[model samples]
Structures are given as C-alpha cells and as structure tokens.
Target chain A: MSADRPLEKLRVLVADDSPAMRGIVRAVLSGFGCDRVFEAENGLQALAVTESGGIDLVICDWKMAPCDGIELVRALRDPARSRDPFLPVIMLTAYSETARVREARDAGATEFLAKPFTAETLYQRIAAVINRPRPFVRADGFNGPDRRRLERDHSGAERRQARQS
Target chain B: MSQAKPYEIINPPNKLKAKTGSIPAVNPEAIKRAEEALEQVKSEFRNWLAEEVRKLERAHADIHANGLGGKHGEALFVVAHDLRGLGSTYEFPIVTRLAKSMCKLIETAEKRAAAPRALVDAHVGAIRAALIQNIRSDTDMVGRELVEELERQVIARVGAEG
Candidate 1:
C-alpha cells in the first residue's frame, strides 16, 4: 500500500545472456522492492522457468542464444506449450526500429522496452503492463494485443469478463 | 497481420493488476531508489564494462581470423549488440554510442565482409578507449566527434551500397 513498495509482491523473471545485465536489472528490481526475481540465460531457460509456473511478469532481451526473445514469445503464446498464454511479457531489446517492434508485437509480446533503458523507463513499462493491458486478438499471424486499438474504451471490468466467457 | 475481417478479441483478466496494481500512482522514489541502488555498485560497473570490452575484442579477433563471413562475424555482431544495450547501464554511455555505430556498420553477415576492416577496428578501439580512459558519456567532445564520424561513414557506406 505504501509508495515505496509498490512492486513488492510481483514475481519477475529477467531473461538475458549477459550476467552483468541480469545483475543490473535484479538490483533495480530489488530497489523497487521486488524480491522474487528469476534469471534465465536464454529463451529456452526462460520457457523452462515460466512453464514451471508462478511468474508474474517477464522482462526479456531480444537477442539470446539458441532461442531468442521472439521465439520465447511465440512459445509462450502457443497453447500447447504455454502454461499461461495470457501472461504479460515485456520484450526488452536494443532494436527500436518499427519493423522490429512490429515483429515483437506479431510474435505476441505484451510490451516493448528498448535498450539504453533507464530505471524510470523500466518502471513505466511495468506500470504500463499493469495499468493497461490490451485485449488479446486471435487473428491471422497474430495472437497478442489487438494491434489496431483505436483508443475506444473497454467500458468496465464486468463487461470484459463477460466477453471472455 | 489482422485484416478487415472477423477476429476474436479476448480481454484477458488483468492478473498483474490483481497482483500489484491497487496503488495506481507510481512512486518517483522508486526510480530514485533504483538509481541510488545502481550507484552503490558503481565501482563494480567498470570491471563489468572491461569484461564486455574484452569479449568484444575477442569477437573482433574472430573477425580477423575468419574474415568476417560466418559464425565469427555473427559473434562480433552479438558482442557489439550486447554492448550497445549494456554500455550505458554500466555507466559508459559513450561506449553505447560507439557500439551503436559499430552495430550499424556490421549489422548483418552480408554487410560484414563489405564493411571496411579499419572502420570496424576503430569502433572496437574507441570502445576500449572509452572504458580505459573513463570516457563515460557523450559529454567528452572528442568522443562525440569520433562517434559522429564513424556513424557518418557507416551511413555513407550504406548509401553507396544502394
């Protein structure tokens, strides 16, 4: 309830090959009062960690060994392999180009955070995923957020829940 | 890839909100605290940066030994890309700038062979110099000019390729 511990209860997973980066992100998350942070070296490991369940949020690097971020997102979105297809995923990458952003989106990433990222930027991204989650669209070549959202209101929670039913 | 057709939109439950969104207002102190936390470990950042630079050098060595064509060139790109992402975080934004330029120069294996070896070496050298000399950010005028010149050449090379 206090401002200092807003992220205290959140369980976060950071998937990156760089140990330095993992430590930096873990430090920042710890500063935000998030104690349950998980680390994975690549997408495959991230998948293993998530498949075992109990991960609240995911922050993943775009480039990784064997299985990259795109592959991870796709795997997580797949019904057969994923435990929680609706889980929120924040795709972390240095590629800020429109094509790469679109690629991540189409692959089913819930959010995108470009690298050279600041702590504030990372916080805002976490906040964005929490404060606003786009409705998942089941369509051709896309299984994530509705890419064509036009700012129309969702009305209310009950209405959304009813639609899900 | 959605088109003008029938598509189902499912508003998944805001599980994250249920978990940690009761307090809508973000605390600025959270960011300040995170920054301070990073500062507490600032001394170690240089060592971490040096290790990354050495990895970049090894990748560059692979480029020299294998002629920037196969897995070796890809390795160079990976190291440069990681540095481009982590340099600023490790307190060397100038390294980030140089790495970004380097990334643009040899982003793909196809471009690696065509990229001038000297230009690539200059980027690798500048990155190491930034770490060794403690040129952390773009505030250093020489570092800024060096990055700009390298970026210019990379761009011109691409333009010529077109």
Candidate 2:
C-alpha cells in the first residue's frame, strides 16, 4: 500500500470492448507500477481471467458485448461462481447518472470512476480500494463488500469504538 | 492514522508478494507517461473521428435512400453513443455535448424510427463542424451557440411530435 509503489507486485485486469480504452487503461496501470496487467474484451472474458486467479484488482467498463460490468460483478460476488469474492472491482463508465452509480454500487462495485476521468482521479480510486478495504457482507439478497462507507453498531456508536475497548 | 493493512486473497493460482503498509504515492513520472500515452491516442483519434463521421454520413445517406425509420436510424444512435463517450476523452468536449444531445433526440423519437430529418441533419452537421473546426473548448462561443441551436430545434421537434 505504499504511496510510492501503490501497484507494486499487484496483478490487475482491464476489461473493455474498445481497443483504445484497453490500451489507455493498460498504460495507466503500467504508470502505477502494475506490470502484470491482463486485458479482456468483454465481461465473460474478464470472468475467465478472474477464475484463472492471481488478479488483485479489476477495472471494467460498464458496457460490452455478451456480458457487462454489472453482470460480471454479480457473478464475481456469487460465492458459487467467484474464485475470490473479496477481490476489489472498480467500474468505469461514461454515464454518470445517479441511477448508473446506484446500479454499480448495488452490484457490489468497490469503486466507481466516471468516464473522461484524469489519471489523478483514477489513482485516487485505486488508493481508496487498497487503503480503505471494506469488510465483505453476505446477506440473504446480497453478497459483496459492505455498501456503507461508515460503520455503526446497533446502538449508533461507531463500530471502531467497540474495537477500541 | 491506522497501520496500512496487508490485504491478501485467500486463494490464487499464483500467490503475490505482500505489499507494504503505506498508500501508494502518486508518481509524477507515471502521470507524465500516462499523459503521453493518452496524447498518442488523441493523435490517432482524428482518423477514428473521421471514420465515425463518415459512418454518420453514410447512415444519413441511407435514411435518405431508403426513407426514414430503418437500420440507418439505429446506426445513428450507435455512432452518437460512441462520440458521446469518446469526444471529451479525445479532447473534443464540444463534440461530446452535441452528440449527447443528438442521442437524446434519437432516443426520444417515437418508435425506433429515425428522428425528424431536420433535427438529425442539424446534429450531424454540427458534430462535423465541431470536429473540422477543432473546437476543443466547451465554452467556445460558436460551438456553444451551435449546440444550443441544435438542442432548441430538437426540443421543438420532439414537443411538436408529442
């Protein structure tokens, strides 16, 4: 997690249908010191790559042929199908609407970066996923990282306070 | 600040080395490299942009050749979506705005039919103009006026049809 080497020794996956987008993402990943970057043209391919294992993070586009990012996330979070359900995922898309953001979040995305994003924003999201790892949550209807940014106990005290004692 | 936690995946085909406990610092050199790579992509965008514009033109021609409502209209939607996604990234913010407006028009049109010919023409024409003129800034007066006029026409057309 060292800021100086955020992506050191990590394997990342970039999934998108556009060759241009894939190249750009790969370049960005390389700049971040992630040398072992894998590329997949669609969600299905991404799933296959993830299943093969060794990937530390996934950066996926929202739209693609055969399968999409949301579908990919759903499958990845499914304990029956996922190789590593705890793997961090960042969803990228041109659509920045509230509905799109909510859809990705509900689908278990670790981070959301809107399209036309700068390297700084991309790096910030990567930092967030690595430095602020959220605990996974498994409920009857949902199986993914916890959605809440802040954690509180039943009595409304911060969960960290309980750990402090 | 809490100690940086070492996150590990329980199972992996190949295990990775444990990372240190500090947030990765933003490397200026990396940013520069990324920017340079993006610039290379941008340089190639002119060809891509030209191709997309040609597709738009052909689609428009097809609509004229085979009447309205057909595969051509769908093609316009696809092209507009592409432009909307790529324009700003390729340093053509105005094109993005115009294409997004065009998408709204094509999307809101009744049925899967081609949008009103005049509106479609206006949107296509404006996009071509923006690209040819190399209007990169969203606030450029001419580009802003062109977008506003196209938007106005689209709204009027949609309203009349509704």
Best-matching candidate per lDDT: 1
| 10 residues in a row with least lDDT, candidate 1 chain B | B1-10
Going through the candidates in the order shown, the clash numbers are 0, 8
Off by over 4 Å in 1: A149-165, B1-4, B159-162
Lowest summed-lDDT stretch of 10 residues in model 2 chain A? A156-165
Model 2 ranges with Cα > 4 A deviation: A1-5, A150-165, B1-21, B25-29, B54-75, B107-117, B152-162
For candidate 2, write residues B105-148 as lDDT tens digits. Answer: 88533633746677778888888888788887668898888888
Q: Which candidate is the best by DockQ?
A: 1
**What 10-residue stretch in candidate 2 chain B is worst by lDDT?**
B8-17
Residue-wise C-alpha lDDT for candidate 1, range A102-124, written one tens digit per residue = 88988999889898888888888
Return the number of clashes found in candidate 1.
0
Q: What lDDT tens digits, residue by residue, belong to model 2 across residues A10-112?
A: 8889998777667778777766667788999899999999999978889998877679899999999988999987788999877676777888988989899
Q: What TM-score would every model get versus the actual structure?
A: 0.91, 0.78
What docking tier does model 2 reach? incorrect
User: What pairs collide in candidate 2?
Assistant: A1-B22, A2-B22, A2-B23, A2-B24, A3-B23, A3-B24, A3-B25, A4-B25
At residue A59, what lDDT does model 2 achieve?
Answer: 93
